[model samples]
Every structure is written in C-alpha cells, then in structure tokens.
Target: MLNNNLTWKTSPCSHSEWSQSDLVRGSRILYSQQWTLITDSNDHKSIRTVLPPGPCVPVSGEVLSGLSGHQLLEIWDRHGLRKCLNLTALNKHGRVYDDAQFGCLSWSECENKLLYVAEKIKNTSIEKHDGESPCRKPQQDRSVYCEDWGESLTNKSVPVICVVNLQSGSISVLQGVPHDVSPGQALWAPSSQSVFLVGWYHEPFRLGLRFCSNQRLSGDNLSVSCPRLSPDGSTLFYLQGRVFGPHNQCLSLQQVHYLYLLVVFRLLCSGFPSSLIFFVFVVASSAGFYDLPDYGSWKLLTVQKDLMVVCCSSPNTPPTLRVGFLPSAGETVTWQTLQQPVMTFDFHWTVLDVTTPPEEDNTHYSGLDFGAVLVKPSRPPIEAKTPLVVFIHGGPHSQFPAEWNCTTAGLAKLGFAVLMVNYRGSTGFGQDSILSLIGQIGSQDVKDVQTAVRTALQRDIALDPNRLAVIGGSHGGFLSCHLVGQYPEFYRACAARNPVINAATLLGTSDIVDCVGIQYSYDQIPTAEALAAMLEKSPITHAAQIKAPVLLMLGGRDRRVSPHQGLELYKALKSRASPVRLLWFPEDGHSLSRVDTQADCFLNTVLWLHQHL
Candidate 1:
C-alpha cells in the first residue's frame, strides 16, 4: 500500500543556538583516580587523582573521537565482550538491536546539535483504502494479535534520526529522511548548522556514508566503517570494506569531502581534474592511501590538526597507540608512538603465506593466498622447540588480525607458539576472498587451514610438528575437528568449542541455520542435492578417520550453534571409544569462552593439551 500520510515533528524543546565551547565544558569533572573503601579499618580512605605513568589504552572497540576535549570510551567487561558489549552485557542483555554504532549516539562539535538515531513511530495515521491489503495497518498500530507481535511490530518499525539542542534542551526529529534509509553514525561537518555525515542502511542490508539529506557518496557494493570528516572538511578519512567482491583486504581512503555546494561551483567553473576524479573510478578496485605507512587493519581514532591518532597491536606486541601527522607536500609524516602495554609473555610474530599451488590438471586458478600470524616466545632457546597451538577464529568471515589477543598470548605463555589463521573466507581481505569459502566450507576452508599449518612447518616457524595441537570455536571449531578427522596423523590433540560437526543437522536446528546452509551449500534449507552437499561438507562425514584425542566445550544457551551439536560429536566420539571429554557451560551461549567461562575453558584446554600432547 502506497500511503503518503507520513509526518514528522520535534519533541519538547526550546529555541536556542549551540556553540563549541558548550561541548568542551562539562558539568562534572572527569577524574583519573580510582576510589576504594578501606573496609578493613572501618574508615574509608581516599587518594588524590594521579596520572598513570604508563600508556593509557582503550578497553575495547574503536576509540570514539569526540570533537571537543571529550572522548567516548568503551568500558570493557571482563566477561564476554564480543557477544553483548560492555554496559549491556554487564546488565544481562544480548542478541538485541545494536544502537551504539552509526550516529545513534553522537554529539556535534558545535555542541548545539546532538544527533541520535532510533526506532520510532511517525505521528500521522494512515487511512485504510479499499484496494489496500488487509495486512496493511495504520503506521503506528498499538494492536497486538495472537501474541505474534513480531510481524506487526516489524511492519511498523521505523528508524528515525532526532537532533537535540544542548542549550535549550529542544529535540527535533528531522523531516524528509525516508523510512527505507536507516540513518546512524551522524557526524557534524565543519562550519555546519545542519550538514553532517550520516551512515545510512538500505533494505536487504547495505551501509554507506551519505550527506544528512540522504544522498549516498559511495557505490552500493562498498561498506563504510568509521567515516570521519577532516578538520578542514576537504577529505573524509574512512576505512572502506567491500560488502561483496573477490578482494579480502580492506583499505583506508581519503575521499573528497563533498559539501555539495563546493562541488557544483568547482565542477562548473574549473571542471573535475585528473587527480580529483581518480577516486571516482578506483573505489571499486584495490585502494588505500599509498603514501602513508601501512598500519594493518587500522581504525582512524581521532584527527588533530595535521596529526591522526590510531591504536593498533600485533600478535607479538600488546595494545599500542600512535599519532602520525600527515606530511606537508613532499615531507614524510612523523609518527609519535606511545609506550605500548607489555604483556607477561614476550612474543615475536611473523606472517606465513599459505599460497595454494595450481591443480595437477592445470586449472586456470593461480591459487588464493591466505596468511596466518605465528607468535612465539622471544626466548631464543625455547622458541624453536615450543609446542604449537593453531588458533582459528569463528566467523570464518572474521579475520584473525595481526593484533594482540589475550587468548593466543596465554597459549604462548604456556609454552606454545600460537598461530592465528586468517583463512580464505576472512574479511579485511575484501568481499571476494571472504565469499571464497562460501560453498567450500569443508574442502577449501579446511585445506586453507591445513595449508597454513603446513606453510608454518615448511618455513620452520613451528620447528616441532609432532608437538602440535589445534583449537578453535564455531567455524574454527569445525576446522579443528575436521583436521583431526581428515588428517588423523597430523594433529596429536584437538579442542573444539561449540563446533559444527554436522551441517545437515545444524541447518534445521541452529538459529542462524540459513547462514550455514547458504555458506556451506550456497542454498537455503537444502532438500535434494543441496542436502547431500551439506552432509558431505560436515565434519561428521569423516568422523571415522579421527585418531587424535579431543576435548569439546559446549555452550548450553547457544542459539547460534546449539549445545546439542557439540553433544552429538561427544556421543559419536564416546561410542567410538576415542579419548574425548565434554565440558558444558550451562549458562553461556555460542561465545562460551568469552567471559564467565574463559577461565574454566583456558584451564581445561591447557590441561587437555598438556595431557595429550
């Protein structure tokens, strides 16, 4: 039903102007001190606020850059972080709509225009027409039918952007933003009262940076991350990732900061130049700022004058922060690195290129190149003889960045060289490489992991192949178990967390079953040949070939990959009399190893590895 009765209005607010000074000044002081009660003496003692001598690092996520002297920081929970975020997780919230991303929570540099993206109802009511479908209800229907409110609620759900004036407390819901285009990540551009950079998502799911008026700047295929307007509003600095394509590596780009006004006059008067027009075409291809030193998988944190600050880490080093100024003309940009936080285990790292070889029949394929980060203790004497633990990441879509991880480092500290494999399907490489493992989940992805392990061995990175073990959760868990089955003689022991033992089984039962069906079989709810294909791609298909001892961890509340999947594998291993043990985290979900159970998982995994290897 095509209805034109939609209307928008401002919330209770007074007319007032905003200023930069308003944002800089806060009602409360931000203290660097930690307060503790001296309960032992029955008298509480307080200490003066003092600056820490070492580097101050963010707890998690990208450091949100506030325009004023303020910085929005993520309070990382010691418990599961990857799943439910900080505040929400601590308050026992999960699997909800994420509002923090985009401009759902944002304040303008001028301090006057605070923007927020939220789901709200349009005030106007729609008139029922004779031709309209019965399902087409009013825009804001309060009726609930048969407890199936999900459908009705979804039909009426509207994502809206509202701006609040800090001075007058006036709230205005911007008019003209179409309901189809969901707006977020609202960033105020330079010298703007209303103009700002907005992240807009269209149906079927596509995210792009656009002008506040809903004008998209990038192509549909590209996905924008952390889009920031430059200080002078000349260029927009953002990390762009391909939503769907062959390339795997994501790149950062400095795009023309289109004010819409400047572009019209400049194009009409001087015409688009060769340099200004280069990005227009190359955006779809491999792109990045070549002149700047490559910081692997960088998120632009903040920009100050000529300097841009970034926080990064490698498999070897702990969290590190650096501020680099853009060079003047031909001059090199100088980066001032902050003292990085050093972990207990002094580790060294290297990238092992697992480039596939051409097939024997000489297929035209040149072979996709996947890389893995191998981190070993820096202690020279033990580095070569250290036991190896290949850690595979879950998403299969997610890449194991050359970043510092507590889990992998803990393994290294326990006398094992950790290898974080960014398999063929991992993102950051681009869309094409990420989708490479779509239907090849059991074959190509397994081969990629095996090849990475082999490459590490061939390069003598993991000096002792006999003392090797593999561990991973979810898709990584699937590969860990597959390695034990497919290459029985290679790995001595394996530990899997919520592994996908049978895709055919997961397709019907798992919450994201369609994802498994699509990625593994390239079909949704496979029936005929697709069903058989899914079975063939599952680890259970080769279960009889298993020789290595196994340890399985199941998350009881896991909706993504139910605990039953792990239990099924446990039953199979027990029936076959294989040395296997099952650990169930009754309260945890798919990310059981994230927070609450991390200690238990770590202990059990280390014990299993020690006993078996």
Candidate 2:
C-alpha cells in the first residue's frame, strides 16, 4: 500500500527502470527486489502490487560510473521475471558508463536489444612471445597515458555505444563512432535500425565536465542531449543550447520535423520547457525557482503514455510523487496523489524578489533581478527576534529552486528563518543574468547576497540582524567565506562546504580550471595579471578581517575545490586566534552527498549555528 502519511524524515523513493511486456497488457515497474509491480485491479478503478518472475540480490554500492564497487547489466523476463541475461562477464569493455554526463540505458521496441554506454576496453594484452599469440595479462608493464573527462569522471575517459541481443546474449560494440568522440545518452531508433546518441568530442583535451559545461568541440556552436524519437519515428526532440558561458544555460527546445529530412524547428517560449518521453510542456515562471514557495522541485521520474509521474517538494515539505494524466489538446492536467509526506512541524515559505541598491554602481548587472526563497517557522518566539540563516546555492550558475532541501528545512524547523538567495549569475533568469557574473564573482555575488539579507531584514520586522548566519557549498561556500571576510561584522557565524578560498591557488590544483578562468574572464593560459585578478577576487584576500565564528566542512576526495582550499582558510583563521571548527569527510566528493556524511554535516551545522548564533 502507498504511504500517504509519510513523514519528512522518510526520503522519497524513486524508480529508474520501467518495462512493459509487449505480450502482456499490463505495466510492470521493477524495484531492485523485483517485487511490487503495480497492476490495475477492480477493472482500472484500483491499483495493486503483483509478484514478477523471481527474487534477485541487491546490486550494492555506488553504482554511478566513478564510484561503482560492482555493477551488473541484467535482463529479466517481464512476464515470469526469469533472469535472461547478465553482462557481468564483459569486464574487458571496462565499466558501464552510469555517470549523468555520459551514460545511456535504453531498450529497443522489440525488447530483444539493449543499448548502453560503457568505457572503451583497455589494452590488457601482454608483449607477444616468439610465435605466440597475444593473450590477456593483468600485470602489463607497458604504460599509456589517457586523458579523461576529469574530476568525478576520472574512470570514464572514452565511452562507446554497445548493444546486447538478449536472446543470443551476444554483446556487440557499435562501430563507426568517431574515435575522438565520446558517445552517450543513446537510444534506439523506432525501427531499431539505427542509434541516436550525443557524441561529445574531446579534441584538444578533456577538462572536468562534472561542474563545468563550457567545454566544446572546435567547430560545434551548440551542445545537445537526450534525443528521443516520436512514436511514429517521424520527429526527433532534444535539448540544445549555446556551447559556452554559464555552467548551465536555459536550454531551448528543438525538434526535427522530418527525421530523414532533418528539417529543424526551434520552439520559442518565454519560459523553459521540460521534455517527457512523448510530450513537451512549458514550465512557466517569472521567478527563478520552479513552482514557487509551495513546491520546491518537480522532477520527472518517468512518463508512461498518458500518465506522467512527477516528484514535487518545497523547503518546508518533503518530496512526494504524483501521477498526472496528460490532457489532450485543450484539457488541463489532472494529478493524482501517489505519495505524500506527513508534516511533523508547521512552516511557511515565500519568494522574495530583491533588487540591487539604487545608489550602488550596477554597471555590469544593471538590469538583472535576483531574489531569494524565505522559509520560516509558523510559531515565533514572543520575546526574542527570529534568527536568520542566509543560504546560498553552489554553481554560481545554479539556483535554489522551489524544492525540499534537508538543510534548509531543518534550519527552519530549528527556528531560523532561511533565505535562499538566487544571485545575478543564477540560471532560469535568462542568458543575460548568467553572463553578468562572467568577470565579477566574489564582489558582485557577495554584494547581491548582502543586499538580499538587508532587504529581508528591512521587510521582516521580527528578523534579528544580530543573529545573522550564512551557509553554502562550492561557489556558494566561496560566497559564505566572502560574506564573513569582506563584511566582518555582518554575519555572526558561517559554514562553508568545500569552498574556494583562493582562486589563484585553485587555478593550479582544481579540476575545473576552465570554471576558474571563465569566472574571472581570463584566457585559458595564465598570466601575471590574471593571477593578480584571481587573487584580488578571492575570499582569502580578506581572511584577515573575518571575525565570525566559522565551521569548515571539507571533503577530502573533492576535485572541484580541493580540500586544500578549506585547510588554507582554517589555518589562516586559527593563526589569528579566531573561533573555527573543521569537519572532514574523507570518502566524499564535492557534493558531500553520502548518507553518513550528510547526517554528520547537518548535525554539526545545527550545533554550530546554535553554538555561535
């Protein structure tokens, strides 16, 4: 039975793989356990779970490309649930590409073939003995250098499209794909005659692609992904955007009217459009966050014909899944509650549209409007002013969408009004806002945050300015460090997760060197003036003035912003005899997204805020 009264602590459950048997007339969605198949009962009025073929052991550990401990490509019978094919024997083809940047998992309409992206087979051949044929050798002395996509994608350097015939259980590496291009996000054509995939060309060299999207082939002017063919295979729909600039741009919707003719039509819209399997709809909003204060984020899990499954949440709410019936032509979408969380506490949220100060020089980002999502507890302390925690999102290009965030909601539950600032450079606002922050990172972003905080304080009478605190990660962490350093007396406390302390220092170490270069508007090649400009814009430049109690969260395995960045700030603050704390997660990356690390980080942040503010 579906749990309608699910609590906030209960994280939302999502399914990735969905299969429908052509022979059977029902829908079967497989969980790892292989049970819980939803079927229409009582003549379509009700739904119930039914058993499939057989039970299987959970394929454990981090399944994403770089973090995988073990991975298996298993195909089971849709009707009987009998295990049909397992491609674990094909280890020579390297690991299957599961990283979001370059991963593909698709099944042909016939269900006899499966298309996926996997790493190019590495050379395991030993030096040929005299008159002896070359054989597999685990310990080869030969050394070869390979340039990868860098950062979290260290293991996935060269990816190739592979197909498997389920009946024969034969794997075939597709030929004709360019040697220089890394093929991913592949799907089979309707007739199953051809394959469509995004081929990312790594010509000169491959930079870190995890956090940066400015990487481009020499002549290609646009980047594209997620190509899907219409049911009849006449139209091709995919997302395309300009190659350079912000890490994320507002990707425009494009369609190929005639697949063979290649006649393209760009769908124009005032807002962004989200694509489902067969449907495309505009997610319109003037505010940066999607759906606003009521809904945090609406994630499309999967689309089954007329039924669309979406996950929605907000700062005060936990993620809930909803099944919406796609309206035909003029009809409106009708949503049915699939899974909803039971709220343990009362809280409310509002979207705040803040403007840059009138007197301040707004030369670069003069017209760009940035704002924040303010979340607060329902009940206020009668005698005391409410504390405020300024939450900044990473990406510098990313925005804090109307979505449920554990940290943001947890802070509000603890009686701290959280202000999630969407600064000028954030996406969803358009290309101009994102471009505004090209040459201005620290100063412009920091000032925008400061202005937002001040504006919130001015507007909300109950907010306590003396109890101000700030928290952010990655570039957001950069701003957190800046907020305390530049305006030493502003924030009472701060928490930075994998922050960029010194851009000049990061240039030599961080994986996304292009991100650093682009932020400061410098060329790829470094110069003395570039170094000076990087240092001048860095948060560490003003570290001597930072007086707030700080909590530093450093991920040892982080490649985007090295752990050295946090240690640099830690050492500087400690040398000044300032109050500071450091929490290190050795196994985590830039996200610190591991379950254990997230729990520890959240607890420590709450404790830190309580201790300092």
Candidate 3:
C-alpha cells in the first residue's frame, strides 16, 4: 500500500563513492569517483568518464596509471588512453586488490616500478611432474578452506606485496615479509630500496578488520599504518593507535628517524580528538583548519603548491567544493568556491547532548554523557503531532555526526522526525567511554537511548509520543530488538536489519567471534558458564514480553552476524502470534548495500512503519 497523501519522485543528484586517488601537479588535478545508475532493465547503459577541464595530462611528463578488475592488471599512460601493458598471468595466482584497506598502486620515486597487494596463490594443486608451474597444474581438491579477514573482505586472505617493472613489463612478489603476518597499506620507502607496510598477525587468528581498527597485531603496544616517508628519505611518518581493547579508537601521529643500522621512533603528538566516528589520518603541523560553522564536515581533496581543494557538506546540503589559499606565517587562509551544492532539502538538524543521571550501583555510568543528531522538517507537517523515528547506528563503537545522510534526510522529508543516537560506547569520546560499554552492552546502550528519547520529548518538539517507532542495523539492530522486548509498551513498531539475537550462538557462527567475548567480557574459549552468561544477556531472553510489531530484514550471506540469528527471533516472535515479518536477500551481505537491495529495504520499512504506527 502506498501513502496517497505523500508525493514520490526520483532525486536530481547522483550517488557516488569517491576513490582515494587524488593527484595534483602544477595547475592540474586528477581524481576518480565511481557511481552506479540503472539506466535500463537490459543493463546496456554506456559508460562515461569525466576529467578536469583541459587536455588529459599526467602528473609528470607521463603518469603511470593502473586498473585491476575482471582478472586483469592493466597499465595506462593516463593521457591519450594508451595501454602500456596488460598482465593476465599475474591474476592466475590471486586477484589484485583495489580497495582502500589492502590495495595499493604506488609508483616508485623513479617512476619505473609500481607496488600493489594481492591474494597469495593457494598451493592446493598437485603437480603432474617436478618443477611444473602451479597455474598449469590441475587442482586435486577445491575444498581446501582458507580463513579470510572476514565480513566485507570475504575473498581476501594472505595479501602479498607485488612490484612490477614498467619498462620490462615483469611482475614479481617481494620477499622478507614475516610469514605469520598479512601485509597491507604498502608503499616505497624513501630510499626506494625497500618497502613499508602494516602487517596483521595470524598468530591466534584473523578477525574482521573492516569496521575494526584495534585488532591485536603481532607487535606489542604498536599498531601502525599509512606509512609516508620524508623528502630526504631519512624519516618515516605514520598513524599509530593502541593494539588492544575496543575496535574503534583515536589514533595519534608518530615518526621514526633512520641512521646507519639504527632506527628510533618518537611520538610527535598525542590525543588528537575528533567528533567523527573512528577517525584515522596522518597530519602535519599546518594541516589543522577551523571547522566552518555552517559546514557539517569538510574533506581535504587535493593540494597544489600553495592552494588546496576541499569538499564540504551538511545534513541538508550536498557536497560543495572550495579552493583555499595557504597563508604564510600567521596570516588567515582565504577560500573561493569552485563548485556549489547542486541540491538542497527543506530539513534541519541539531546535535543534542544527552546525559544520564547517576546510578548508585553503576557509578561508571553515572553522569555519563553522549550525543545524538536529530533531523526534522523545517515546518511541522501537522499542527497536531508528527510521527517520530528513532534511528540507532550499528557500531556500538561508532558515533553519528551531523553529516549528510541520504536515508535520515529522506525519512525527515517524509514528515517524520529522526533521532540518530551515538550511545555511551560510541567512538571519539575517549578510551574510557569506549571501555565502559564492554560487559554492559544490553543494559548500558539501551538505557542511554531510552533516556535520550525521553530527553528529546521533554523539549519543545512537536513529536507524537504515541506514534513512535525504532530502526537500526547490526548492533543498532540488537538494541532495537532489546528496546521493543524490554520496554514492550513504549515503541509502536520496530525494524531490525541483520541483528544479533543470541550472543551464545553468535560465538560459534560469526566470523568476528571475538566480538562476543569482548562485549560480554568473557573468554573466547566457550564453556557452559560462558554460554549461559551470553544467553542471559541476549534480546531473545525477553522475547515473550515483546508486543510491538517487528520487521526483520536480513541478508542471507551475512558473514558478520549470521542470518540464523534473525531467523531465530522471527520464529520466536511468530510462534507467539506477534505481528512479525522477515525479508531475506540471498545475495546480500551484512551491510545489504547493493543499490537495488537498499532501495527495497528502505521502501518496505517505510510501508511497515506506516501501516503499524
């Protein structure tokens, strides 16, 4: 059923994910961003490429560009669309990685060589004769299972560093990387004689590294990444964070100076705070800039000489590009607009500070404060009371900032107030805040959200208390299920996308099994006592108390929280004769991020909430 009073129309702007390939030389800038548009049902839409105005010139006389897809490694001249070389044999070992985590296509200082990461070829084939090429041999067993980095990196494991000589068109894997470690974020050392990369140890086992940054590495007290060398080749700069505890935390800048046969690392600075979730970057002294009052977020695009390009946006504003002139000494920097936002929405948002009252038994949570971003229409749709939607973010460790979010804004445009809760354990607050949520998942996070909602309602906001609903994914989904179950009468409706229902079952089934242990503050090696503890803390324990209608949207192939988790809850709710529904996407993963799947999920959610509320 459709809402007849509401109008539906396609958006005027296109959605895109920017690649980290920004390059600048003289007055020219080069970058690549990708977006998908379903032009027709036949999928025969022509592809187009857009570049900055002027001839397609490389950074230097000739830029070395590379592309890895469809089992092919291609090198181009960047200008004139000339193909320099194609290496089809290399992918026979393993597919080349082009993602931000483990992928790299870096050129050496001399520009004659390129470095990248790829999966190591499995040695599961039996050679017919001695010294036979592994690629030429037939595989005797295809069932030899290999553990990967988990979640979004399902196909990635054992990433090896590979370098290619452009002049000779020859590729070879570099040696001397520790056998027990998986390498990523590779780059050429300033000397160009050696390589630098971050290595994750397979010592105990590999965990999902996608949303997690504090995974235990081989080195103690030192987790490093994004290695950059100084101009003189005698110093190395990188971002360093703790090697233990919560998955997402703040990182600081550190540097290492090189001498003959000796190297010393010293911290340049520490405790750089950010309001953004899981902030990670490398910075210099003058890299700091004032956060413009009107802009929700600003991203540095590229720099050329004394000028830098930046992109800024907010909840209601699309991205706008600006060029800033770098000032010398103490002079103020000046900025000029290069591209204005193409569209705007009739919505407004504010960051609310939510504080919890003192709990005598749990003094750690007493006076604990968090934040939430509320998005609503500029003008209320009805003089009476408008419906409100409480939106919870997934990562118990993630924070929600006042940045542009299409889904949140779309819900607001539909005349519903949206509240994005950053909960107590969310990142950017400090180390103690993150640790506070461990062993206190269900109780602490749930109380904070309920308190935030109560606080929001007490304000002069025109939201209907009787027409309230809840929606979330992953950990947020877990919270959503907990809310409707424990406080069964508060919410009118609920939606959970790939939520965690039973922590005990998740310990055995989830790829990131460590999450269960860390969140519950238990040992990973399961026992009867541990399992009992997990079951007691799960949302399913309160299933009998749930009266609110639940809409469970799950991905069949989710590697994070298995689809079985959602199915179990569906069965529990259905058996009780509750108004429960489940929508399954077989090809989707934990994120349900495919364009078509996302559209269907949100549309169905709107229909479900509208019908029930």
Best by lDDT: 2
| 1-613: candidate 1 lDDT, tens digit per residue | 0001111122111111111111233222221211111111331111122123332222212323333433232323347432211222222111122333443455566645555544443233577544322233565653523111121122323444555454554445544444344445555445544334344434332221111111233456565555555445665566665443322244556465554423211112111111112122112121122354434445455443333445656665555444444555565644544334455345777777777755411132235677898888666444456678889888767777777677887777777788889877787666557555666678877888888888888787445788889999988999999999999999999999999988878776653323332532223356677677778888987788888999999987776676788888888888999889999888777777344477778889999999987
Stretch of 10 with least lDDT, candidate 2: 272-281
Flag the better candidate by TM-score, 1 or 2: 2
TM-score of 1: 0.65
Name model 2 segments beyond 4 Å from true.
Answer: 1-71, 78-81, 84-92, 126-145, 261-305, 328-331, 516-523
Candidate 1: lDDT over CA atoms? 0.56
- TM agreement with the true structure for every prediction: 0.65, 0.81, 0.82
Model 2: residue 113 alpha-carbon error in angstroms? 1.0
**Considering TM-score, where higher is better, how would the candidates rank from best to worst?**
3, 2, 1
Deviation in angstroms for 442 in model 3?
Answer: 0.4
All candidates' lDDT scores? 0.56, 0.70, 0.70
List candidate 1 stretches off by more than 4 Å: 1-103, 119-159, 170-182, 188-227, 233-300, 340-345, 360-365, 378-385, 427-432, 508-525, 557-559
By lDDT rank, best first, the candidates go 2, 3, 1
The alpha-carbon lDDT assigned to residue 140 of candidate 2 equals 66
Pick by TM-score: 2 or 3, better one: 3
- Model 2 RMSD in Å is 9.4
